[model samples]
Target: MTEEPVGTLAGIARHAFPKAPMEVLDHVDVSVEAGLAGDFRGAVKPGGRGRRQVTLIERGDWEAAMAELGHAIPWQERRANLLIDGLDLPQVAGTLIGIGAQVVLEITVECDPCSRMETIATGLKAALTPDWRGGACSRVRRGGRIALGDDVVILDPLQGQLL
Candidate 1:
């Protein structure tokens, strides 16, 4: 199958609070069981099924969202695990994205902005509404360490099939 287009991992952020400032990190560990190391979402669920092991946002989308709001806002305020560049983060579910050398994430759903966003900035929630601006929630498939500047690759299931 043909390989999907490549992108870049621009940044990484995580926080312990549901509505607190995200702490940017140079590198973070990702695993099927715990998600990002120390990330709040890593807490085990009773059934061992958590779709939000990690979250990712496209830098382009973030910039567009900010421009639509008429100002710049910190990336941390979005509360995503990774900020990616040069990829159009498909809104479709079941998409698989490979981060760095070993981490693989299956896109589960759109990460809708919550009321907490409004707390981060006025009009923030509304600003993040269109074009999957808020980002995507994913579950870790294959776990590994991810760092800034890692290669982001999309894995299209229909790669070699005739449409």
Candidate 2:
């Protein structure tokens, strides 16, 4: 028998720049707990076999992460490939992030951090905000893959609650 995940899709990558190269992502990972991420892959680029990873942005770490890339890009100004505003990964593992008439996803395993984040956003270790900053990444369990301009909707919340 298998168990189900919890939580819902609060928000998705507010902005997605599919055209941008992997240099944009400082770090990527998967998370399980409520406030902390689980595992991470760091950068999002070429060279992954079957294990894909999710990118993450620490609170104040965004600035430093951007700097390491030799660009003055601001954190808020960045267009992440996939943005999740709220909702815990572990809590909402089975939930789906619904977009208008297109893609949806079931919460898979928690995404943890990889090497890129350690190098770029070292400050992230100390700057993680509970409510703000940024949420973690997720694997697309169902529906089509997400593209730009897709609207996200949370299918559930903590304890099957809806907001």
Best-fitting candidate, scored by TM-score: 1
Candidate 1 per-residue C-alpha lDDT over 1-163 given as tens digits, one digit per residue, 9 for 90 to 100: 8655789999999888665568899999988888899889865588876788899999988898888778788886788889999988889888888888888888999999998888777888998888789999999888999999998987755661211
**RMSD of every prediction:** 2.9, 10.9
For model 2, what is the alpha-carbon lDDT of residue 68? 45
Q: Model 1 misses residue 154 by how many Å?
A: 0.7
Local distance difference test scores for all models: 0.85, 0.37
Alpha-carbon runs more than 4 Å astray in model 2: 1-80, 85-91, 128-134, 156-163
Q: TM-score each candidate.
A: 0.90, 0.41
Deviation in Å, model 2, residue 79 alpha carbon:
11
Candidate 2 lowest-lDDT run of ten: 30-39
Error of 1 at 151 (Å): 0.5
Alpha-carbon shift of residue 139 in model 2 (angstroms): 2.9
**Given candidate 2, what's the lDDT at residue 10?**
23
lDDT of 1: 0.85
After TM-score superposition, the amount by which residue 73's alpha carbon in candidate 1 deviates from its true location, in angstroms, is 1.2
Kindly list the per-residue Cα lDDT of model 2 for residues 10-129, writing each as its tens digit: 222222233233333322222322111222232234443212333333324344445545555444333333443332333334555553354444454334433433344554423333
